[model samples]
Target: MESNKSGFEPKNIWIARRKKQLRSAIIDLLNQYHEVPKEWIDEYNNHTIMSGSIIDTIIIIKESSTNCYEVQFGNGKSGSIVYSELDYEFQLFEATSEVEQVILCRNKVGLTKDKSFVQTMIDWLTSIGFIVDVDNGLRQTT
Candidate 1:
């Protein structure tokens, strides 16, 4: 996702350029202090298992050297990535304590963009003791 420094309009979804820069910086910070890996999986059958499963296209970052984070992106509406022989919906479902943050990103053009979805996702993250926020920038959340 991409956005400009002027901030996104009510009709845009991609990460604003400024937000993207902040996210990259946060990722870099996490990498500097912990093992930051993307798209990891168990070795058994190469199943795409990260922290937990949410839905058909969302995967929660529940397991990592740093902490827990639910990084949601892509939609089953499009050609969403799939994993596991069981064919589980790959959404970030698990609200684990190990996760400290939740990062959600989407194309912004095709998603529901409903605050309910975002709030629900945030509720889930906060319920499990994690800092939750849209991946607009690296603003810390309690």
Candidate 2:
């Protein structure tokens, strides 16, 4: 689905600025890690999120110095990649709310891929005082 970063008031501005900030920060990181391989971007990232009918987008994990998160995938195996290391593949999804980005990673995790990730995301967002809906990809609520 197309992303919805727009909203009333200064929110749309804030989201736009945040997205720029993150992209800049990640670019700086990439400059520092110049030798990072294409494999990490292609092989590791382009993998399908799940094996079967419930499959969704091809997924990648990303982190930044400001954000480090992990997700469970395949028989409890978990992996994380620095957000800056995401390459061009993740730019679209990662540009959304950071919380949503992490939830996407979480959804891609684990063989079962159930609602627990959604539950966890709802808890996290609510804890931070952001009324968000996980099923809606953490879109802020009115």
Candidate 3:
């Protein structure tokens, strides 16, 4: 097994690189398809994407005090109730054939805390040409 400067195995490094590519593609698609605010996107790119964290999902929320948006990664379960007012949330997962499966939710504050949000996400994913299954949250059909 080959290792890079970080000492990560070749497969691990490849996975990391692939995740970064997928994250970029998802962000680009969001900008293309949605009317997302530039500040929100910028924060995600700078704080979340550039941080090199293996994030399963990202929640962009508007801070009540600052009135500015920020990126919160992971499952979006932790944080104060006020901070949980999510403006947007998206999950990126690997799919077969280099295409990434994306599950997106928008404009629902505290949506992540609700168990029913899974069904909501499934409905949205199916509407946009992704197949949801028990094992994999989503998969895109070629």
Candidate 4:
């Protein structure tokens, strides 16, 4: 196997470069999403997995009846709702812990359909080259 000047295998170097590209693409996607509030981006930029504080997963639950969206930021084990939107109007607030957030989301959208909501987001992330662990939510795959 060929090695680079840094003594790293070529395959390892390629993998590292690919991971960087995927991370950049995911960040770009988040920034372009209108529903993601500026505060979330600010917070994300200030932290990282290395610091033990990063927005590991983003759960967007859509209330079918009201056509509203509840956006939550998950850090693997727990999360909180950071933003919500209805009728094209949105509000930003940090309320409730992951347990409460889950109950609220279930009450609004029901548990039976919640997987689809999360899976859809996961699918999109995968399509964009971001590796996701369905069981643990999003993390720094690099």
Highest TM-score against the true fold, candidate: 4
**Given candidate 2, what's the lDDT at residue 111?**
17
Candidate 3: tens digits of C-alpha lDDT, residues 1-142: 5545885566655655765665566555543433334454344445444457533443433333432223343433322112223455433332223343333333333344453544454344444443222112112211
lDDT string for model 1 (1-142, tens) is: 7766787464322323433444355345443433323322111112212213332223332323222243543222111111222432223332224543232322111223453333444444444433222443322221
| Lowest summed lDDT window (length 10), candidate 4 | 133-142
Q: Which has the higher lDDT value, candidate number 2 or candidate number 3?
A: 3
lDDT (CA) per prediction: 0.32, 0.32, 0.39, 0.40
Please say which candidate is ahead in TM-score: 3 or 4: 4
**RMSD versus native structure for model 3:** 16.4
lDDT of 1: 0.32
> lDDT: which is higher, 2 or 4?
4
* TM-score result, candidate 1: 0.21
What TM-score, over all chains together, does every model reach?
0.21, 0.21, 0.28, 0.31
Query: Is candidate 2 or 3 superior in TM-score?
Result: 3
Every candidate's CA RMSD: 18.4, 19.8, 16.4, 12.6
| Number of clashing residue pairs, candidate 2 | 4
lDDT of 3: 0.39
